[model samples]
Target: MSQLHALAAAAGVARTWQDADGRDQVVSDDALAAVLAALGYQADDDDAASASVAALSEEMSRPPAFLSVDIDAPLALPASLAAAEAAELTMEQGERRSLPIVRGVLPPIAEPGYHRLQIGEHALVLAVAPPRCLLPADLPGVARKRLWGTAIQIPSLHERPAPYGTFADLREAVRLFAARGADAVAISPVHALLSGGTSFYPYSPSSRLFLNAMLVDTSTADAGLSDQKEQELIDWPSGLASRQRELRRAFADLTPEQRQEIDAWSERQGSALHRQAVFDALSLHLDERDWRKWPADYAHPEAPGIAGFATEQTEEIAFHLFAQWLAERSLAAVQGEAKSGGMAIGLIADLAVGIDPAGSDAWALQGTMLTGLTIGAPPDPLGPDGQNWALTGFSPQDLRQSGFAPWIATLRAALRHAGGVRIDHAFGLARLWVVPEGRLASEGAYLSYPFADMLRIIALESHRAGAVVIGEDLGTRPPGFVEPVTDKGILGMRVLWFERNGNGFAPAEDFPAQAIAMTGTHDTATVAGWWTGRDIGWNRRLARGNWHNEETQRMADRSALWSAIGSGTPQPSADTPAPVVEAAIVQMGRTPSVLAIIPLEDLLGLEEQPNLPGTIDEHPNWRRRLSGPLADLLAEPATARRLAALIEARRA
Candidate 1:
């Protein structure tokens, strides 16, 4: 009823929201004013709220330059366009034709692409997308009715060769797993990370637009690599320096033809590649990690000074490009090996929802990305204080103005060489919790995006890539959101820990066919850890939450999980946990879901999960390396048995 509340709601801010504990908390006026300011509005009081509302009204009242719709779908235009008599449509490939705009709706596009629409003095970019993404059954020569995969955080895979494992180790995994009936290997975000002075976690990437330079193993030089010992935890800084030195050495050894090839690849990548290279080059001179903290002269990519800087530091920019090129070649070879080895879906790439606000993506995507606000989560049962990811995301308004090119670019990059792409926190496409800088996570507002348009773009990109699309659609979602994602042929992710039906685990067969079935995500506990309450113990030890009081509930969950797995009652304790680790895999394999991916941790029955949410230094997150080499994993009896059972069930 308050004027500030009205303006906040109108500006896509949730004034009152229900927390995970089922308690309603109203958004404070300060939070509203801060979030509104980030959105380019100013509302500190009732009068300011009215002014902000008026400003929004005035801005939105202008004619938009772009609109998006699915192919053959109704193209609804604004009321202002209702008076337009005729418009000229220009397709991407230079074809142009005039069509009538009848009753404010343009004719359904027969083709999907970026097309220009002209109505006298008004011109708009129209993005028409394909109906749905590539599906499992649509893959050429896919034998199994239901597909299955194994998900792993690549860097965490402990192998003898390459120390902390490399693209080379991952390549060998395809040949080994393809024979074992694993069609896909879902990886953590391989998006380019800041090589030096950054967290090793793959989720919080510097730039989703590029590849991690250090993951590329440029060698045959190290004959003793096969015998190299693995580390318990990845020393990212040292590892990156070692890999970069090797990559530089190889680059120096390249011939004229090889140099030309690198130059050609850079040219094809165009502006996006150059922009990122510029950002990386600038980092060498600037002490500040965030571009926001940099001198105003070089803060933005498109600034006049950036071009001069790029020219002055051509070699530095080239080094970054060379690194990306190496990573790309290695990644492409892995995917090629997967397909050649008879895998239907070679690799599944993970796409982090947002980019680091201080990273290359933020520098490049100035038009489409929002810098003043950070994406976060509302207060939830898992974390009572909520979570601040401290990442920047796309601006819904600017995305439309730019015709969603940045989004399209990001998606294409992820799906380029993968058999499937898993979108982390897919609910992000619908809406995001926006927190202003210096604000607590709980004091944020849910900002809405152009969900329908973004989904269509994703579907279009998915079809073009001929890759399956999987969305990690967990957390708070808008009503009827999952259905649309599934309907668009994008598989929704379902974890075992959350798929409860009336206080009991949902039956495997009851799992939806258009989804990805899994025991746990990287953010959750492993099957072995959850069974033994190791996750709860870690939480208590790390002082993350009040998990010490949830032993009874945690045990109850263990019993329900085993009961759902048809393993009678579970008597899980510290020393002797229930024998449901492999059973859990069996249950997941039995699901009617299109694909079931078992985490590597669960496959090895590791007590320590790959990642423990909410703690960095307090816990060993993203540090657990695999027990042995890629081939040794296949030799494991658990791997053999689980793969055999999963493949047999899917085949049947």
Candidate 2:
């Protein structure tokens, strides 16, 4: 191998890869160099490369601070600690054990937790994980072989004059769905976003560690604010401004005892919460969007100037802390309502693949987050030029060296108030396509991560929370990826649109019993929209694709889907999409998969999708609200029949 290729290999950068078209593609030297630099390695010259390689060698020689292994699995000790005869192990529950190390293989641990291990003078955390996540069959009180659920965009349930939905609305939704035999209500990411901004995409979160404060229910803290007429779409900028005003007024009205309560709760959140609160306050005070543009000293969370800034902005920071508290409590109430309503697995939370580079997660967790690199997909049929999501992710080396603290924290946050979590773009856990700043998305390299360790950590957290885990493993995956994921008891997603059998839709029984079946996702065209070629119209209007060809294909797809639903079923024309939508829901529900989830849009026969990929403002993405209150949502005859059909299908 060439010197650069050797260095890249050592650093976990893929030199060559297979493309979507099954063609061999090589990472350009320029791209490799840029990625290596982002990983803190100098690769401009041979001398620099040698020095960096030597540095990596030295770092590898050092023992890791932590080790993760499956329960009852023997772990090989690091070479440096192999000479030790016996080690002392301390369980998380305060129990201790002294086990002999036979030929450098530590005895298997029967329990799963963060246990301490001491060998001679060296100490490390030994994280023992269960073999798999908590599955539906494993859930207590859940006896059914097939479970059904409905997915929704949280903001789409707005029935009041608040312009956007609140947790109170979500609570009502949980009761409504649970009454209809649904076990889960999967919702979009509630992760924090840039407040008061026109863009309200949930996936581009400012911080995954905290909930979106704008989604709080402020009816009790109305503060006599003027009300706007309820509309079909959310006015995010105005709605968030009103929410901010209401929250501020509520804060001002807090008594001394209430303030003390909030202070005590904030203290329990630890340093991460403090950093997030500081970031929110400083961003508003400086009137800046990105912290990188802030005056140098105030940019970092722990810089010298940050101390004085926090002192000067005490009230502002406290207000943010208070808002977060309210958001958490509000969401908790929704989950409580779901469980109390007799749902087996309620509120399946969505975890976005990455965070906006300018967001709070990047600023607060700088020690682990990668800089000057954005994550996205390589060239695919849908995106000929490749796609850049403009999001930042964790550094593989830092994750290993830091004991996967950031990863564990993110998982806990997602699973905090939900009985399940669906990981978006789960392919990221194994490898991420990282593009350097100022480079084309096509010029990106696949950076390898510690997949085994991360998966074990996920299993550990899933068991601890007693939450079922689902991975969005839809796109092109690495070789041998699905086996381990299924072995770990993580449910893989099987979307209806992509389940093709030759030139036709696949039979419902074809789906694996271990996976979750879905009629559609937030990103895809709804069943009604697909039946009527609504997506083709949008693509044509936006010049995204050849609309003429797509329209021709849609006609054939309609017939195929109709045939797959049932023999002798007549295909519905473009003008009549309601029957198709109903059939699609029932068809997905009849799958042999563990769970079947239909989007609210499809359940209601709505023609527009919640989101149209590849468009920022061209489409009304993430802004549409449901037509009626969730309580009366089932009043629609079509919706009622479709849901009843779903329940019957699942029973089959």
Candidate 3:
């Protein structure tokens, strides 16, 4: 083997990967060197490669600070502590016990939590996790046979007072869905994005630790900010300006009691919340969104000057703290309302795959986060050039050393007020395609993660939060990925467009019972949109590809879908999609999957998707609002009929 290949192997970088076409794609030597360099390895020459390999080995030889093991799974002690005869184990709840190590193997922990184990002078955090994540059937008062929900883009609610939806609107929608016999409402990511940025993509969050303060309802405070006229698309810039103005006014008007309350709540959140608030304030003060552009001293969370800045900018930081507090409280209320209104699973929050490279998470966790690397995909059939997401995530080595602290915190934040979580691009947990910054995405290598360890941590968190975990495993998963994911009780996604049998759609009954069935995701075309070739129209207008061929394929797909739903039902013309939309909803509902989520667009028979994948500015993604109030929309005869059909099919 080449020295570079040895270095790459030592660094957990894949030397070769399989592309979407099932062909082996070898990672170029240059790509491996680049990826390894990003991982802090200097492998430009054979000598450097050997040196870096030795360094990595030395690092790996050291005992990890933390270890995650499935409950009842025997754990082998680190070599340093292997000779210890006995170890003292401190449970998370302050309970302590002495354990005998039988030939370096510690007995399995029956309970799941972060426990401290001490062997002589060596100490490590042992995370005992449940065998699997919480299942949908395990949810109280939920029927295992069939459960259903609606997927909504929170901003699309478009209620009064504010042009875009807030948690207030979300609460109303959740109640409405619960009344319609829905068990859950899977909503788009509400992770904290830029405070007043031009880009309004929810998936690219500033931080996954905190809520999006802009989504908090400040109307109750009568902040006196002018409300924009209700429109089909969200004017993100204008709306963000209004939101900031409103938040400032609301913060100024906070009573002494309110200030004390927010301070107390912020205190409970600890340094993570404090750091986030400081980042927001610093951004406003420096008038720079990118932390890298900020003066070096003030950019990092632990920088000496940052503490002084936080002290001096107390008022501004307070406002951000107040904003976070309000957002969390509002979302908590929505979850509460859903549960009280008879929903079994309530809200299922979407966890974005990664955070913006220039965002707060990147700034705060710079040491553990990738610096010169960004996450993306390798060249595939769908994206011949591959795709760069311009996002950064935690380092696998750092995660092991940090006891998975950041990851656990992120999971806790996502499940804080929701009954479940849908991990976006869940395959990323096993491995992430990492590209060197400024490099073409195709020039990337797959970085292996501690898949088994991460899965155990996820299960531990899931059980602790009593939340079901649904992995968005819809696309090119690694070989042997699904079985482990399934074994861990992480529900996989089954989308209507992708559930295929040759040219025809798969039978509803054939869908896996452990998966979550959905009509479509925010990125895909809506049912009505697909039937009428609205997506193809966008592709043609954008000059994305040969739209004529896409249109022809869509026509055939429409026929195949109609047949799968039932040939007895008359096929509707492409222009008339109401019948097809209704049947599609019913078809997905009939799936044996524990959870079926129909996007609101499909339920309303709307011919527009919330997002178009390729076009950012050209497509009004994440901005389109519902035609009317959710309650009224649900009351419409057509929507009501489709929903009723869905419920009936689920029950059947």
Candidate 4:
């Protein structure tokens, strides 16, 4: 490719001019006309192209509005105080400074508390605690609450051809969870996926903010018209078809007065209605392909036909809004039920790093997104080939210029109906590995971001929402990742499988005090699967000739692993029963971490994982449904007592 093309591609631009230095430069109207001439377009007909170039230039200069924040002027210390505290004040990179003070300009120091100081456009904070310790009161928000949750895929709730089960089934699940002393249920993304069998993956959603209509329980609307007896199992496609049919019938049966009420409600939620409308239109147009393949005129948000399309899909859009409202109501009901039944926290939600590049958030906020690049992990022991999530992240510069609006918007949405939020790939807040278009994952490089500013935004939002934040700081973490975020009252994540210090699973006493301890995550094998050697066996088979890949190499490097506990046998199998693995995890619960979350699969002695990292279609990812009803699973004598004992011990 030409240098200009390379630069344009890197910047996620389709057409642009370049400076003499080969840098992609903002093209002037006249310069755009010259480029068009070179591309065979007549100069006399360049008015449209010239206007487009001018608009693009304007957008490049003015960043998104949401990323902006105001910082107050720094307090000027008196001459005497400056002289007295000269040794305590330290100058840092670029205009930032750390000083020892009772309190700066933001507020008066009340009992040696840390204060976040903002001076003009610069934002920094001071740690004003006692000599060596940090207290929760010194942080920006309330002390982080413990989060206990289980991961569930909304789509997996379906039996076969049906989309999802009845609301009654969901209610029963909540009731069963309460009986089992479970606090929260962490579910997969319920974002609307493309319908018509386009893509089954829930993560690659058509819209992030909207709820998936497939999950809606139509029985809650009008009971008698739907056949309650025939609903056997979840058949996603069939279930969706049945729900749609029932929804249409219910709409027909609605009186004119009822229709008016719905319309009035839609009018009140104007923005939500508009967003849903956009999603409906886009879903209809794209079918299965990405939005970029759409006709040229339709590509731009200001295209002539876009408004009409939005109008046409209004009712369908309203239906989507109604679905979200119902989901919120259902979730609240679950939380209330859990609380009344004696659970401490209810419904800790997981927030994925980024939306699918072809999804709604990316489409709506196109200008701010880093479109051509994909977010992925650096080479790690788990996946020697590394991982490219195929998701697009926001540009750091665009995020700052936009006042970090997209991040805030997403957090606010997740926190809206959640008790706590688990930030997947939380390390990305500090820096992300960005692989440019068509590049191998190894070619990716790290890009730094203003994490402190981002954390400040998160703290402010979470504090206001009365929700806790958990950072999933697993895998090869960067230097000093935990200390600052933990200091800010965000809890760290601890997985037993990876916890070790020159020996098998780190001693229970060594676990951190402010963390959520669990045996495994959605990406890893269940406790039973791990002990039985199923995870390693599967990895070995998949790796084939690359069997000695980096992951295996790491495992070889950690030969001391599992040795102290007396498992000298090299090749273990799934024949190892549940009780043994359960004991190991229960031991972890005795640690000082504020929270302990045991996956239901592990709790039930299941050998399968919810998801496998590298493979998508090859494995049954997000398809595993609970083998039995929640009530039945909770009633198993041994399972119930063991779990209850763990909860009791932890509570003590």
For every candidate in turn, the CA RMSD to the true structure comes to: 2.2, 1.5, 1.6, 10.2
Tens digit of per-residue lDDT, candidate 1, span 167-258: 87788777677877778898988888765565567887889988887778776444444444556776666665656667778877888898
Models 1 onward score TM values of 0.95, 0.98, 0.97, 0.73
By lDDT, the candidates rank as 2, 3, 1, 4
Question: Clashing residue pairs in candidate 2, if any?
Answer: none
Between prediction 3 and prediction 4, the one with superior lDDT is: 3
Cα lDDT of model 2 by residue, 495-534, tens digit: 9999997868999989898888999999999998888888
Q: Which ten residues in a row have the lowest lDDT in candidate 2?
A: 221-230
lDDT of 3 at 518: 91
- Report lDDT per candidate: 0.80, 0.88, 0.88, 0.58
Backbone clashes for every candidate come to 3, 0, 0, 22
Model 2 segments more than 4 A misplaced: 220-230
lDDT of 4: 0.58
Poorest 10 consecutive residues by lDDT, candidate 4 = 85-94
Better of 2 and 4 by lDDT: 2
lDDT of 4 by residue, 1-652 (tens): 5333333333333343222234553433343233333222323344544444455445545422322122232444333232223223222222334444433222223222223443334433342332221222233332453324455555444222234443345556656776766666666565666544545566666656655655666553434323432343334455456666665565556678876776676677656446655655566656744667776555656667677777776666555555555555565665577567665555666777776776666666777777667778655555556567888777776776666667767777777666677887898888776665666664455555667667767766665565667888886665567777877678787887677786555766788877777778888878777665567667787763354463555455234334423235453333754555556556655777777777777777778887887887666776666654566666798678667656765655
